[model samples]
Target chain A: MENKVLMKGNEAIAEAAIRAGCRHYFGYPITPQTELAAYMAKRMPKINGTFLQAESEIAAINMVYGVAGTGKRVMTSSSSPGISLKQEGISYIAGSDLPCLIVNVQRGGPGLGGIQPSQSDYFQATKGGGHGDYHLIVLAPSSVQEMADLTALGFDLADKYRMPAMLLADGTIGQMMEPVVLAEEKEISKVNKPWAVTGTEMKREHNIINSLYLAPDELEQKNFERYEKYKVVEENEARYESFMMEDAEYCVVAFGIAARVSKNAVVAARKQGIKVGLIRPITLWPFPKKAIADAASKVKGFLSVELSTGQMIEDIKLAENCKVPVELCCRVGGMIMSPDEVLGSIKKLMGGAK
Target chain B: MTTEILIAGFGGQGILFAGKFLANKGLLEGRNLSWLPSYGPEMRGGTANCSVVLSDDPIGSPIVTNPDVLIVMNLPSLDKYENAVKTGGTIFVDSTLIKRKVNRTDVNVCYIPATALAQQNDMPTLANMIMIGKVIGECQVVKMDGMEDAVNKIVSARHAALKEINLKALKIGNDYKE
Candidate 1:
C-alpha cells in the first residue's frame, strides 16, 4: 500500500495542481476556499511559481486568462459569490478557446447566502454561468481523494479539449479531511501548443488570441466549431459511479457530499430489504445520462437528493426521458440532508411502489 | 465496526485539533477515517465542532448526525447535541466548564474535569486532548498504542516541544479515576 497522508479537500486540490505542472495561481481570498490560495501563496514562491492575490475575483480570473493565453498551466479558485464575479472572464476565456482550471468551492448563495456548503450553483455551472453559449467541463469530487485526482484530470481534459474546466465542489468537501494517496510526481509531458501567443520574432505570422468576432457570420461559425468539440467531450468524457445498480429497484441520483450521504442510506435501505442504489455523477456537464437512462428501464423510481432545492433532478428527468417517476429530496440555505433523512426518502419510494 | 464521534466546544478550545488527532490515530491503525470540521464565520469564542468517523469498512457520509460518542466542552455544545447521541452511546463532558449533568438516561455519561485537569497539570490549553483521552480510555474506539505517533504526525515540527506535554495530558485523563 502506498503512503496515504490525510489532507483537507481544499489543500489536496492545491497540491495536485502543483504536481500537475500548474505554476501560475491567481485568486482572491474567500471563506471555505481561502486555504487553497493560502497554500499556493506558501508553496509557489518556494518553487519559483507565480502566486498573486489579485485585488478582486474579477482581476484574479483575468489574470488566469492572461496566463492561459501564454500556454502555461494556470488556475484560480473561489467560492460561489466570488465565482459569480468571475463569470464574465470565464465566458471570455471559453470564447477564446483557452484552456485553464477554475475551481468553485461552492457556498450557499443567492446573494452571499452563507459560508456553509451548498450545491445550489448547479444551474449556473452546468447551464453556463457567464452567458453566451458555452460549457466548461465540470468535474464534481465526492472525496478528498477525487479532489486531488480530478484537479489533475481537469487540467489535462481542459488542455486536450482547448477549453476551461471547472472543479465544482461544495464547502463540505472543501473543508473535510480524509486520507488520500497522491500520485507520485513525474515529469510532465506537456501537450504541444502551436496556438500559443509566444512572440514570432519575425520567423512566421504573428499568432493572435482574441474572442471578439463582431461579424455575425464569423461569430456563428465559431460557436458551431466549439459545439463540435463539446459534442466529442459529451460522448467521451461523461463519468459516474454506480453502486449496487446491478440489481437495484430504485435509483438515487446525487453528487459530492450529497452522494456520500445517499450511499450510506442505500446501504441501510438494502439491509432493510429495499433494493435501492445510487448513481453519483463525477462530471456534471458531460453528465452520466446513459447510466440513468439504463436504470430507468429497470428501477421503479428515481430520487434526486441534493443540498439545493431541486437542481439535478431536471437532468435526471431529461436523461430518463421521464420514463420512471422522479422525485426530489433536498435541503437548502446551507443545510445538508442526513443519511437517515435520505433513507426515509428511499423508504417512501418503496412504500409508494407497493 | 464504525465509530462516529462528534466533538464540540468553542472555536479556540481545540475542538477541531482534537478531532484531527483522533483521525490521524485511526489512520495509523489502518482504519478508514474522515474529519469534517464545522466551518463558518466563527470567531475565537464562537461555537465550533467537528465530526470524526473511523470504520473497518469504507466510510460513506463524513457528517455524523447521530454520533456514537459525543464529547462536549461547553454547555451550549452539550445542549445542542446531548440527545443526538445513539441510544447506547457514550457522552463525555468537561465538568470543570459545563456544570450541568447529562439529562438522558439511556446513554452512558462520564463527566471529567478536563479543564481543571489541564490547568492543574500546567497544560492550560489542552482540555480538548484530556477530553479525547477520556473518550478513548472509556470507549476504546481506538487503542492507545499508536497515540504517540499520531501526536508526532499532527503537531508540526515547530511545536515539537509541546508534543510530550500533550501525551502527558492524555495519559493523565486516560488514567483518571471516577
Candidate 2:
C-alpha cells in the first residue's frame, strides 16, 4: 500500500519534517527555497509548531539553536548566500554539540551568484563553512524523494551524534516535482538532553552548553572526540548508489542533478554499446571513497561531472590511488550541462583510455 | 530499459502536471521514476517545462538534456527543445500551437491536435491531459490505465473533480489511432 504523491522538493521537506516530529522551524525566505518557508508558515500553526521568519539568517539559525537546546526537534534552511549568513551560528551550534537539521537548497555562489541550482557549496558544506575546528554531517539528496527522506535522516543523525547535520540539496531538486512515496514516520520519544539548561532547581546543579574551552588541551580533546565521531560516521554512514557498475568498463561520478543527467547519459552511451555506468554519492562528506575506490578495478577511469569550476574533482582525485585517471566535466554559474556534453566527455575519456 | 521525456509549454498549460502524470504511471507500473521541473521567476506568465524520466532501473539523473520523447505544447518550447530530442526519438507537437512540422527526418513526429481536441470536447483546460495521452500513445512509455491512475494521484489533492474531464481527455487522445 504505497501511496504516491507529487510535490515540490521544498514543500515535501517541510511536510516530511512535520511527520518526522519536528516541532519548531526557524528560517528566512530565500529564492529557490522559499516554498519551504511558505509551506512552514502555512502548516506550522495548524500543528502548533512555531515557524519563525527571523530578520536575518543569523537570527534564524540562533533561533534554531535555542529551540534545539531545549531538546526539541528543530530545523532551518536557506540558499547559498543565506547559508553563508548562518555559518557563524552553524559553527556555534556544532561546537555546542547540538542536534538540529540545517537544509541548504544550494544555488550558484561565491557571492550573490544566481538562483539556478548549482553544487558550488560542496567544499563549504563538507569541509566546515564557518571559522572553527568542526564538521557538519552533510547528506546530498539527488531527488525530491530524497529531499523528504534525507531531512528525516538529517534529524536522526544529528540526534544520534549530538551534532548538527545538513541536508545539502540544490535549487533544481528543491523546485522539482516528483511522485514520492512518503514513508511512515518513526516515533520521536521524549529525547534526553542532559546538556540542556532548562534551569537548575534547589536540588540540581547548574548546566552549561558552551563551545568555549579556553584551555588548548580541553579543546584538543573535544576536537579529537569530534574526529572520532566523524570516523564512526565515515564507517557507518557512507552512502552511495551504483548503476550497472558490475561488469562495466566506463563509469561516471556525479552528484545531485548532475548525477541524474549522467544516469541518462550513461544509458544512452550503453545503448551505443559503450558499457557506461554511474556512481552517485549520497553523502558528500564521507566521499563514498570505498565505493569509488572499488570502482577502479572494474572501470578504466572515472568521469567527474559537476556543476562548478570543477570542485568535486578534488575529491575524485583523492579517492583514487593512481590506478585510474579521473576526468572532469565542469560547468558553473547557473548553467546546466547537457547529457550529450557529458557523453562527449565520457567518449573522449574512453577513446583515450581504451 | 529507461524512458526519458521532456514536457514543455506555457506556465498555465499543465506541463508540470503532465510530467508528473508520466512519472506517476511509472510508479503504478512498478518502475523506478523521477520528475524534475524548471520554475522560478520565469514561470510567471511565461513558459515553463519539466523533465520526467521513467525507467525499469533506478533513475540516475532526472534532468533530461536529450530526451527520448519531447511533448511540445507551444512554439517556444519546440524551439527551445527541438534540437535536444535524441536521434530517432519521438516529438509530439500540439498542432494548435506549432503550425509548422518538425523538419528533422531522423526522428518520428506526432502531430496531435491537443488544443483542437480539448476545444472540441468543450473542455479547453484538458489540453495538457490530451498531450499527456498523446505522449503515452505515441511513446507507449506507460499504459493508459497506468496513466489514469497517475492522473488520479496527481489531481486528487487540488482538483479531484477535474479528474474525470482529464481522464476523458486522455481517453480521447489515447484512442486516437493517429
Candidate 3:
C-alpha cells in the first residue's frame, strides 16, 4: 500500500505484462486500448523488448502467434472491431496450443460501433470468437488494481494451460485512474518449454509448432487431447468474487465494469432492507458456474447486470440450471447502466420474487 | 465518507488534470479513489469532463452520475450538469467563463472567477488549479497539508517550475473570498 501509484487501467495492464516477463508486444492503434500499446511502445525499447505496430489487427495477432511459437510471453491488445479482426489468428494459436496473452479493452460494437465502454463482446470472448472449439482463459478486471493483477495472472494461466488468455476489460476501467500497488520487480525466470521451437541443437527430435494437420484422425486426436487439458483448467482455474452473499435472498451476477456498478446497487438495496448480494465472475471463459449453482439453492432469484443487451444472462441461467428466476438488467451500444437504474432492477427482482 | 466530484469544461481547460490531481491527493492520503475521464472525439475541441470519487470505504462504481460536488468551468457544462448534483450537494462554477447564475436552489453553489484570478496572478493556465483549491477549501474532502507532495508526485521533474506556480495558484484560490 505504501508504494501505490495512480495509473490508468490500460497503463497498469501494460506495466504488469512487462513485469510478468512479456518481452514482445504487437498491436495496432485502437481507442480505449491505445494507451496500452503506447506504453509498450515507450518502454519496450528501453528494455530491448520488441514492440511492433503491425499494419493490421490480423498482422498483429499473427505476430503474436510467431512469438508465441518461440515459447516466449507475448501479447497484443485492441478494442472490439480490432479484436474481431484477430479472431482467425487466435483460433490458429489455440489450435497450436501456444501460450500467449490477448487483451481486449472493449468498446461498443457489432461493427465499428462508438468508442464508449461496452461489454458487448462477452459472447465473442467467452464462447469462442474464432472458428473451432477452443477457449481463451478470459479474465475480467473490474478495477484498475485488478487490471494489473489479472494481466500478470493471464500470462501465468496461459503458460500453465498451454493456451491463449485474455484480459476482458471495458472502456471505463481502461481509461479510469486509480491507486494500485504494483507487484514488486522480481527476477523473472523463464518457464521450461520443451515444446518450444527453439533450435534442437541436434540432440533430440525437432520440435514443430503448427495448426495444420493433414490427417483427419491426427487432428481429432489433437482436439481430444486439448479438451482434456481444458477440462482440468475449467475444474481448477474458475475464479470469482462473492460480495455480501451471506444470508442474502437475491443475487446479482456481473463482470468487469458492470460488476462494479452492481456492487453499488447491492449496497443500496441492502440499505433498503433487500437481501441482495453480488457474484462477480473474474474468469469469464471458465464461467463461475459453481457459484451460481450453489447460490441458487439459497437466493430467490438472480439478476444479470451487464453493459450489453443481456448476453451474460444466458450463462447465469445455465449456471443456475433454471432452478431460480433469472432476469437481465443491461444497456447496450457503449452505454453503461447507472447504479440507480441497477438498484431499480434489484428492487423489481425483489418484488417479483415476493 | 464518499465524495463523488464531477469536473466539466472545454477540452483544453485541464479538466482531466484537475481530476488527476484530486485523485492523487486521495491516493497520497491512502484513501480509495477512482478518476474516470470522458474520452472520445469530443475531447479534440469540445466539452470534456471527468469523474473523481474519493472514499473511505471501497468505491463501487467509478462513474459519478449524481455527483456530490460538481465543478463547471464553462456555460454548457453548467447547463448540462446543474440538475445532476445531489439535492444537498455543492456546485462550483468558474464565473469568469460562465456568465449565467445557477438556477437550482436546492444545492449550494459557489461562483469563483477562477480564470480572472489566475490571470491577475500571472498564471492563466492555473485556473483549474484555482478551482481545485477552492474545492479543497470548501469541501474539505482532502487536507491541505500534503498538496506539495501531491504536486511533486503528479508533475514531472522536467517541469519542476510548475510545482511552484501551481502551489501559488492553489493558495490563491484557497484564500479567495466573495
**What residue pairs are clashing in model 3?**
none
Q: Tens-digit lDDT track for model 3 on A1-354?
A: 479989999999999999988899999999989999999999999998999999999999999999999998999999999999999999999999999999999999888999999999999999999999899999999999999999999998899889999999999999999989899765655677899999989999999999999999999999999999989998999999999999999999999999999999999888989888999999998999899999999999999999998788999988899788998899989899999999999888878874
lDDT of each: 0.94, 0.86, 0.94
**Model 3, span B64-113: residue lDDT tens:** 99999999999999999999999999999999999999999999999999
| Residue pairs whose backbone atoms clash in candidate 1 | none
Deviating ranges (above 4 Å) for candidate 3: none
The CAPRI classification for model 1 reads as high
Q: What is the interface RMSD of each candidate, in Å?
A: 0.6, 2.3, 0.4
Candidate 1, residue A164: Cα displacement in angstroms equals: 0.2
For residues B39-105, write the lDDT of model 2, one tens digit per residue: 6765645988888878877766677878899999889889889998999999999998899889889
Cα RMSD to the true fold for all candidates: 1.0, 3.0, 1.0
Docking class of 3: high
- Model 1, DockQ value? 0.92
Better of 1 and 3 by DockQ: 3
Chain A TM-score, cand. 1 = 0.99
Model 3: how far is A325 from its true place, Å? Answer: 0.8
